[model samples]
Target: MYLYGASGHGKVIAEIAEELNISITGFIDGNADIESILDYRVIANNADGLEGKAVISIGSNKIRKLIALRDNQFDYVKLISKKANVSKRAIVEEGTVVMMGATVNSDVQIGKHCIINTNASVDHDCMIEDYVHISPNVGLAGNVEVGEGTHIGIGACVIQGIKIGKWCTIGAGSVIIKDIPDYAVVVGNPGKVIKYNEIQKLSQ
Candidate 1:
């Protein structure tokens, strides 16, 4: 296995790789300044030697998607921690990672390049779209639907059957009860939208 980054996100994935006992060949980083990560050597760019399966250890949804799209020569590896409790019925797509202590209940569908962070709980039948990040300690009740590229902040709670739209951000410690619209930045105890179309605009 190889990692496509060597920064903080890469460090977390390196730990996951170690936990899984997967031997990392090296990290393919563009930055020449980065020498090594936790004793693993950093190769300057993928052309140096990287091939076959690798994971893009980037935290940004936009950059991760871009890298996935741009790099078709190498296969993307999905890194699911052994410590995570993912039901056999759950469907986790390629390039996604279910971190340690995370719980993915029955029939949950996690899309490509998504991050089900440490200690997050995704309840039964939840649909997490592509590039979404369910941050550490986040909770999603049964049948909740998260749109593509949306971010559920750490410690946030999504009530049962709530639908969160694409590119939206649910602030940390917020309680989501109502459906959020696209590109909305929601926060507070009932998850009110503090901003709208801002995320989309920034992306554009």
Candidate 2:
């Protein structure tokens, strides 16, 4: 399998693949200048005509979504690290990456092309939509709903039954105790809405 995006994120994915004994053909990068990562050759500026499975390996939810939507040729694979504690009852869709030390509890529904980053804890009955990024050490309580393209930053904690809307950004170390609206940029202990992401709104 090939990992798209030759960066630090891609290196993590490569490590996970190695842990699973999966053979990596190389990396596929948009930047021509990036020749290699972890001694693996990088195919620059072209995903076309590449056979076999691939993982996006991008940290950015928006970029990951855009690449998945734009490049439909390669078969996208869901990557779950061997060290991850994923419940059998969880439904993780294709193109999603569950990183090492992550814990996904029962009845969690994680959508396509999502990132459940290292050591993240997603409690039971959570619904994580497509392109969502649950950053390292983040915690989501039971029944928390994270909408499409939303990014929950590192070490952030969301309370039970909270609904985080689409394209929202929950800042690092934020404590979310209430429902977040669409395109909102939230931060602080109570996770106040610092601003709406006008750039994301305009892109849509």
What's the CA RMSD of model 1 in angstroms?
1.8
Q: Where does candidate 1 stray beyond 4 Å? A: 45-49, 197-204
23-118 in candidate 2: lDDT tens per residue? 999999989999989999999989888878989998988888888888888889999998999999999999999999999999999999999999
Measured against the true structure, the TM-scores of the candidates, in listed sequence, are 0.93, 0.97
> Which TM-score value belongs to model 2?
0.97
Which candidate's TM-score is highest? 2
Q: Where does model 2 exceed 4 Å of error?
A: 199-204
* Weakest lDDT window of 10 consecutive positions for candidate 2: 195-204
Q: What would the per-residue lDDT of candidate 1 be over residues 147-183, giving only the tens digit for each residue?
A: 9989889999999999999988899999999999988
User: What is the C-alpha RMSD, rounded to one decimal, of candidate 2?
Assistant: 1.2
Q: What is the lDDT of candidate 2?
A: 0.94
